[model samples]
Target: MYVCPEGHMAYKKARSLQKNSIKNEKLIFFFDVEKCKCCPLEGICHKIGTKSKTYTLTIKSNLHQEQLDFENSDAFREKSRMRYRIEQKNSELKNRYGLKKSMSNGLFGMTIQSASTVFIANMRKIIREIEKKGA
Candidate 1:
């Protein structure tokens, strides 16, 4: 769930080395930065005046394959489920609060519009619960 600044992502191919370690069960993670520099979207990630982008990830945990598979098997599916809720909220904000057509210009105005939409959505959910109780 992390966005790399350098736009490069590397998955290590050193599984054998990690297996030879003391634990003999390890998750070897590699971070290769050079690959990112040569990417197609390098311009967007590496712009002038911007600090050097770095994509660093480390994972050296020792766990059995079955254990790791059990833990991470449904991770991608869970992320997809979470995305649906976020997208629904964004659509609601655009349709109900006019987020697509800003009422005022500038970054500050846009911030307020987004904030208010979130607040309104939460309030509406709470009010519905209260009304159900009263009825």
Candidate 2:
């Protein structure tokens, strides 16, 4: 059983396997859309007179499900603190190192600029550590 984006109950219509070169087996879940048409929130959830209403969800195999479970676990919340720190670092880089505005054009130039900015940020961190130790 799967719920629609608008909280409408949708029954499972079909399930199939999708082959990919990445070695990850993808499972496709097809949900019926017939119930969606009669939903009270149909005006908000979907446009009127829309045809072929169906929802499909593509998920990976056991490993991906494990990952999903972990993401919802309390351990993942603690791990996500690191993500907040990383986001702060990114914000600092963008604000202080002119990363928000590109200094060069094209993909290669952008890569060089990003690498240099990160290198400078790391160097600054190292310098701050050294200064603290010296003090």
- Give the Cα error of residue 113 in candidate 2, in Å: 0.4
TM-score of 2: 0.45
Q: Model 1's lDDT to the true fold?
A: 0.64
Best by lDDT: 2
lDDT of 2 by residue, 61-106 (tens): 6887898999999999998977988899899999999899988889
User: Model 1: what TM-score?
Assistant: 0.42
lDDT of each: 0.64, 0.76
Taking the tens digit of each residue's C-alpha lDDT, what string does model 1 give over 1-135? 344555445444344344446555333445444665566666665563444443333554545656667657788668767998999988987888677787788999988888887898889999999999999
In model 1, the Cα lDDT at residue 18 comes to 46
**Stretch of 10 with least lDDT, candidate 2:** 23-32
